[model samples]
Target chain A: MRHRLKDVAERAGVSVKTVSNVVNGYVHVRPDTRARVEEAIAELNYRPNLSARNLRKGRTGVIALAVPELDIPYFAELARHVVTAAGVHGWTVLVDQTGGGPEQERVAASGIGDHMIDGLIFSPLALTADDLTGLDGIPMVLLGERVDHGPADHVAVDNVAAAREVTAHLIGLGRRRIAAIGAQRTPEGASARLRLEGYRAALAAAGIGYDESLVAPASAWHRADGAAAMRQLLASGARPDAVFCFNDTLALGALRALHEARLRVPEDVAVAGFDDIEDGRFSVPTLSTVSPDKEAIARLAVELLAGRLAGERAAPARELSAPYRLELRESTEGPADA
Target chain B: MRHRLKDVAERAGVSVKTVSNVVNGYVHVRPDTRARVEEAIAELNYRPNLSARNLRKGRTGVIALAVPELDIPYFAELARHVVTAAGVHGWTVLVDQTGGGPEQERVAASGIGDHMIDGLIFSPLALTADDLTGLDGIPMVLLGERVDHGPADHVAVDNVAAAREVTAHLIGLGRRRIAAIGAQRTPEGASARLRLEGYRAALAAAGIGYDESLVAPASAWHRADGAAAMRQLLASGARPDAVFCFNDTLALGALRALHEARLRVPEDVAVAGFDDIEDGRFSVPTLSTVSPDKEAIARLAVELLAGRLAGERAAPARELSAPYRLELRESTEGPADA
Candidate 1:
């Protein structure tokens, strides 16, 4: 049976008002009375009416984390860190999958639904700067790709530097003919574009002329897309010595494609990817990739959101960069001089 | 700015009572007035105070989904489906990770935190039947593993049948010696135990004596655990012609170990797994496993919770069985007479 405040007070030999004061954290309560009330609460197993309390405070102790898809290992791992970080702030996290759709992104951004969250930590795939205008006063922290002048605090690793490092690592392995997968042409593909620019920069630094034909475009960053792109590259007779995929999923797919085509990894064509997800660590020839500091990113995002929710609404949005490192694994550790 | 009912009332040229009537789904409002009010609500993009409304109704539009871990691809994939299924009921899902800790499981099962959810869909790993007593009145639906006489509805695929089918398939490949990975010897390991039982049953059906050394024990169903178990089996000189893993993650790890040992899959030993996760589909030799109808499990769990929330509290808790099928892939489809 659910215990009422009156029952708790009666059990504690105190009045209902005193019990309410104790439950609400009123500082004027006597220590002995508070102890008695707490005992009664424990005995009765009385849980506070959180909805009613939050209603009066005009704040729900819940936040939302919106991502493109939960099935993606990168997002799932990142979300695990986010949930852990959010727990430090005594907040619960509700997840929303936007499926990379503009309409769903807008709905999540606006927080216009029956279950209103105190804030949102969003990793957008489809939303643009224009879509971020007028956000209905819901605090939000942006993750992944940067939105120019977007009205939210942002947290991410330096994608360009990370990608450039991966490419340079491959070039250092004597891979002159390097193919790039996951080049996106849309404006919303900001992160992919940055990585592509990084790849070109590395090629320029190494005095290797960029080949347009070696750059493959994948509309979506999934295994199927990567596999199809790799197949197209092979079918077109582009015998690149190395392939740099935009992400780990794409790289794994490229590996499968290479396997299907009877091309040995690293021996024939070295492969590299970004985002050191768990799958990469166990792949047949373990993947070489860039490992973003996901925990720091998650912690920073939640801290920024907590700051905004804690009456820092007028503070200028901050852009924080987390760290990233290159994980040179079996996928790219080919012959010293092939 | 957050718009109020009075703002919508003025924009629609109606009284506050009429606006409230339309918003609250009172049927007495005129159709034209309702349309005008809805238009104003749209123009203003007003969102109702969900906490306040839910408090008055003694319900929260939020539900909790407590899983052991999200980084595990299986749970991540299942969470994606659950979130989609919960969306159909117009309810938001808050995710909590228990980390397979009994204390954490108890806290989640009790729902004692500040955020009170209307219902919970819990996939427990450490929680026991006794820990489920006196749940503080939170409607719950259990997922994965059967807890006999537990005070909640349960939804899952038949573990025994799925495991038996997988083993039988491996045995059908003209393999005499079969090994099983992921044998847990704990009370909390209900699903693993059931799968182990099915493996034994399959061996008995085929009139093959069970080899004690062929059964490998993994403390956890992670890639590392699976790899270590497989390594132990190989080190102990157990040259089983086939191996059935409890889950895909374990199978993937085992595959990596086999690769390390220079053993060709399905030539020296055929491999099988359970839970046809996305990773399994993309594995080097695409995994052969049981594909549980995850969408159906998610939908049925949500439907049961919705029923309980919609005044079916007295109904006897249901035990719903979801469908499953074996997906034969490159992992197990060896030569005709290997």
Candidate 2:
């Protein structure tokens, strides 16, 4: 049964007005009556209605992080940093998993939870720039899987540049015939396109034409997908001297395939990955990969969202790319160093 | 500036009563007046105040997942399952990182966000059963650390039984002088104690006297702490033929230390860890671990919270334990198999 103001008033032996005054923190109530009303409220577990007051105040002190999913290590780690950053700014985080689908992404962007959230950090995977026309007035910042931007704030690393840098690193290690792993036939907002472009740019810079046969297609960018792609590449008789996986998850999978095949990394077949996940550090031969500053991206995105929520508008929209670095580890560090 | 209802009413050229009726979906408003009010609302980007409605209805349609932090892989994975399970029950999750401290855990449990959340799924690292006394009125489910039940739902795996099973497996593998890694002096709950007890039970069952020197203490459960503890165990010259880490993170770190020390696993020493995290599956030499049914726990906890929200009073408190299994892989597969 729901407890009402009348019930609390009856319990306190006072009128409903007295209970209301006490619950609302009004100073005009008599001291003994106030104490009685407080006792009654506590006994009833009656919470003060904060809706009208919150509506008047116009801030909920809660922000939301809408990611593809929490199971993915990259997004999981990114969410950790985002939650921490939001906490520093006195905001809590509501986490939503959109399953990386266009329909789910639209629902997340439709302000369904706007009543309790001050802003949103949306990372759309399946939605394109054209699909985001309805997100006009939401105070949201975009992360990961770069799309053509709407009027919202966006933060991401330069994927093309990072891929090029990692490819160059492989080239500098005297690795030609580098097989491109994790190539998706259908692109999501130019992410795969930019990475592929960077890989091609590096190959062109080294005077090696892109080999269509060496480009292994993957069903997904997970570890299993990387492993499958490597196996497919091996079966096709490409015999690439090196493999450049799209992400660390794929690279880790490739490393497992290499380990299984008794092929020594860097010595026989050099390998590299993108996104320096924690697993990359703990792999057998620690992974050599690109380390995009994830924490910096989270901080910048949260700060940008906070500013927009506070009605600070320097520009109608802002595009900030987080810095990236090529991290050298044992995976690509050849036998000479050992 | 905050958009006021008066501004919306003025823009719609209607009395505040008509605008309020339109906003509240009251049928007393005419069709043209309703359309005009909605247009003004769209112009103002006005969100219906859910706080007042939620207060009256006594349901927020939101739940909270209060974990220590999402950086840890086990917690991250567990949270993923929880969010999915909650979604199946039509509840959204508001994730809060309690920083693994008693103070923060208390705040998370004290109904601080009760006005906006229907319940909480808390994974406390520092709070004990005694500390959770006053959280009776709130709908919550405790995960991981086994604090005494305080009228809240709880779900966990039997840590003691699983630990014993793994230790017995190590003993069955023809290894003696088994050293324990990742023992915490200050236990969060029966989790560490039960695991340690299980290890001791296995040794006792095998008629091996408890050797204090073989037990290594880790201050925290991270990989670094495990590696440091392993190094300390090595420096002490215990010379154990096998090691059982409290969790996979510690085991991975211990594996790194064992690798650096030139110990070929299962040949020089065998290693086993708890919690079959994803990284454990793809480690250089695949890790052997105890796989707790995380999804089952998530489903049960979410169902329990939903039932509580709907006022199903079949039980005031429920305690459930998910099943676990021992997963064997290359880490302890031995040279004979090789």
Candidate 3:
């Protein structure tokens, strides 16, 4: 049998309003009264049926997070951090995969206004800035590219800066023949474009001319694509002394391809990547990566959303950047006998 | 300005109830009326708010999945699969990490009834049969370690059988003095116990005396823990010709330790693990292990939970065993000299 608020109120010898106030965590309630109400609630096993409570307040204490895909190590790691961050706020996280498509991203963005959840944290793959016009009313914290600067709060590392830093690190070791892998041909290629720009900047800063022939094509930011891109780069006669991949998954795939080709890492080809995933730490040759503070991004996004949900939206759309560091490992420890 | 259902109803030239019927996906509405209502909805950009609708039906079209920790690759991969499976049923998945503690596990299980969600799919790390008592009222599907049959439907791989097969595979390769890592010391370690039992079963079948000295203790099922266990085994003067880790994380850790000790894999000591995580597929030696059909497990858990949410409580709680296979890779590819 289900217990009601009235039953708890009766058992606690308090008004129903008082019990409700205690349940809602109102500060006006006396500590003793709150204790008594909680005791009664425990005695009767009365859980506040969140759906009914949310119906009255239009706040479900849950948030939707739509990412390109969780199967990807970066997204999976991001989702893990987001879930941890949401837990601190006593909020649940509803995860959806957009399959990196505009239609699904739209559905995910629109879901905030349509679903029972409080807000959304979206990391779009295919959705453009214009695609976000209709999603203006929702409480959203955009992750990944700042394709548009309209209404949503944004959290991300300085992609261009981080990429530049990684490329510069490789260049410092006298590696000029650097091939960039995982280049996407879409508006969603915001990461690719920014990272490539950073790579070009580093090359320019070092007075090295940019080489377009070294750019490898990728259907998506995945391991298989990275491997294919590496194979193509190998076959195209564009022999690069170093490979800088967009993400860790791509870099790992490239490493696998190099291993199959009987090339010793950092001896024949130095390697570097972004999004320092766990696998990078455990990989055979380890991995050198631009370690973006993913947990920071997740925490900041949740905190920003919480602030907005608490009706404290008083900014020109609050934006925060995650800190990043260059982690050097065996993969890019420089050429052997240096 | 936000559009309302009433505005759409007026534009469609229909009563609010007729428009509501069409919005709720009721099939009784005439085709033309349905078309008119849909057209009006599209024109006005009216979105149905799910909170109000869920208040009427007590279903939020969202389910909670509580796992030990999403930071673990196995659980993260499992969460991805669960999200995909939930999508097929037009349901959303809210994930919670329990930190693999008894208190956290209890909180996650209780969340199903207290939150604005339908049902729960739980992978408990520190919960026992006794701990799952009050959770019976909430619709739940249990995963991992069949310690007891309880009231909830369960889904998991046949841990005992799978462990036996993997161990038998090692024995067939002329490996003796096999060591086992990640033997949990808590009652919550049902998976550990079942797998250990299967290990003992295999040894008995192979006419090899069970060696208790080879059983190393691990505080948790992690890479670091596995590494520590392997180190302890090495220091204890227990020379094992083969190592069977409880999970991939542990196996990877063991491999790292072995690498540090300059032990050639398969030549010095062949290694195997459970849970064919993606990392295992790409690890240096390409870990040999028991590959449980994780996608199938996730699909079955979602299907089981869907059935309960759909009010289909039938004959005695249905329990299923996930498909398993022994994937022999470079780790157990036999002695390199051979």
Q: Give the best candidate by lDDT.
A: 1
Most accurate candidate by TM-score: 2
- List candidate 3 stretches off by more than 4 Å: A1-58, A111-115, A146-148, A334-338, B1-57, B102-104, B110-115, B146-148, B334-338
A273 Cα displacement, candidate 3 (Å): 1.3
Question: Pick by DockQ: which candidate is best?
Answer: 1
Report RMSD (Å) for each prediction in the order shown.
Answer: 10.5, 14.9, 9.9
Tens digit of per-residue lDDT, candidate 2, span B86-142: 653345666777768775577678754436677888888887766776555377788
State the lDDT of candidate 2 residue by residue for A1-338, as single tens digits.
55788998899999988776554434466767866776676677554454465467676666778887675678878887886666534466767776686655775776544466667899888877666755553678888765646667789998888899899989998888899887776756356777888999999999988999999877578788888888888888999899889888889888888888788887888889988887777677888999989888987788678667655545567788899898898889953237
What TM-score would every model get versus the actual structure? 0.81, 0.81, 0.80
**Where in model 1 is the C-alpha error above 4 Å?**
A1-59, A110-116, A146-148, A335-338, B1-61, B106-116, B146-149, B335-338
Model 3 DockQ (Cα-based): 0.27
Clashing pairs in 1: none
Task: Residues A1-338, candidate 1: write the lDDT tens digits.
Answer: 77788998999999989887665545467778877887787688675565665677677666788888877788988988887776544466667777777766877787634445778999988887667865564788999884745888899888888888999999999999999999999977898899999999999999999998999999888888889999999999888989999999999999998988889999899999998998899898899999999988997788688677656788888899999999888899943233
Model 2 docking tier (incorrect/acceptable/medium/high): acceptable
Task: Residues B283-335, candidate 3: write the lDDT tens digits.
Answer: 77779999989888997788677667655665467788889899999888852
By TM-score, highest first, what's the ranking? 2, 1, 3
Deviation (Å) of B62 in candidate 1: 3.6
Candidate 2 segments whose C-alpha is farther than 4 A from its true place:
A1-56, A112-114, A187-189, A335-337, B1-58, B111-114, B187-189, B335-337
